[model samples]
Target: MNPDEDIKGMFDCCFTIFYQLKGFGEEILEDKLVHKLIYLLPESWESKKIAIIEAKDLKKLKLDELIGSLLTYELMSKRLIREKGKKIKEQGIDINIIALKSSKKHQEDSSEEGSEDEEMVYLFKNFARFMKSEKERSKH
Candidate 1:
């Protein structure tokens, strides 16, 4: 699927959950959700993620602000990836394989530095899994 589709799906899923929680009178803490959302973002969003993490009064952060930042980063990343794909195509190389290779290389290179994004992604995935399971359970 294209990056735009993937990003829309992510946004929808997160926003749905947030809406449900709020509608149910649940106390949705800004800081915690913001942290999870940042972690849930792709590595290409490192700069935005870092900025959010470093922001003061994180507890007071608004959901709209987080969503806007994510949307901006998603669009920027999609454009960059599209441009890179075009370049790779002009060189007569398979973009998928190149992407896979680059992804592996990135992981390897960042492994030594203990990438916070990696850890955050892991946590975010686990949390998403949990949310999915909980949602399924609630359906029963």
Candidate 2:
């Protein structure tokens, strides 16, 4: 949950602690563990956390799905930051006056490119559904 640390590392550290607890005879239910993971997420992840909470029933949710959504969000955000930085460099817009660099053509071009990455979308929706279906079939 440290803003300075990456989400992937933070989650991994939590899992390590969780395993240590298990080794020490402290049993944690999967649902509780998943809930705790979401609860401990930083403010920056509020939107994603809310989406997961509202979109799915926690009892049926797998830990991997939760992490996948979060990691996908993380990657998408990083990609956006990189793309925005590249755009700024291409435009030669002084960071000091970023507000003044608003141009209609620039806005239109950005809009046309779409706000969300298609690959990330596929990972969250299509891929997740496919995985869930496969898991259910395997259970039978």
Candidate 3:
């Protein structure tokens, strides 16, 4: 999976590839599909991946359910990040500086081989924008 692409985009791309493979008499089982999708997720999604894997029988897990769960996780993460930023701003601290510093610190700390999913990077980008706009609103 490409970490730069959104989860939905990644799923769509995989489906397209699967369609092509079907023409060549290569058929992948729905059960195995779930495994591939979960395990293929970026390292940042490890917890969710593990949860999905352990909480249900792979043979019984539908593709729609997997995608729904992933999308839910993404949306929840975004909301939590936004809410945290808002609360920090209300505390009269400069969250923008903290966000930038922590993000950079994270990158510096991660090994070259370790990477986060697109969802996290997306959340951080949105959080930075939210903080910037909030600062501008306060200026007015």
Candidate 4:
């Protein structure tokens, strides 16, 4: 398969999995199965893929950085859930709560820090001021 096609295919699969799980209940999103599907998506898909995943904590995320962080969190959540499930299955007990706690922590850690827009805003303001100053000088 072509490199780009493969990435698109993987992203489509993840999208399908997310929609399918959504039918069962939002709780399925918290399940390890969904997380694994999300993890299967390529790192390059992180920006586009993040827009599809449902995250409660994403409210504070900046639009520009949200996509990448969301993808990273999705991948981490899936891995953590998979490992937790494997251990529980072997030990004959469910550690869903523990998995959730750890996944939340990882998500928080993976989320992008600071706002890029703030710097852009400062730069824009400076440029505008410079343009206004130039206009005044030209009038003189």
| Total backbone collisions for each predicted model | 0, 0, 0, 0
Arranged by lDDT, best first: 2, 3, 1, 4
lDDT of each: 0.77, 0.88, 0.86, 0.60
Candidate 3 clashes between residue pairs 3 or more apart in a chain or in different chains? none
lDDT of 4 by residue, 78-114 (tens): 6997997798899875555778877786768654422
- Most accurate candidate by lDDT: 2
Error of 1 at 41 (Å): 3.5
Candidate 3 residue-wise lDDT, 10-124, digit = tens? 8998889888998999999999888788887999888988898889888899999999999999889889989998998798778558888788877787764254556678899
Candidate 3 residue 17 Cα shift, in angstroms, is 1.0
Residue-by-residue lDDT tens digits, candidate 2, 78-133: 99999999998999988877665556556767755454566567678988899999
| Candidate 1 backbone overlaps, count | 0
In model 3, what is the error at residue 75, expressed in angstroms?
Answer: 0.8
Q: Which stretches of candidate 1 lie above 4 Å from their native place?
A: 1-5, 42-47, 55-57, 93-140
* lDDT winner between candidates 1 and 4: 1
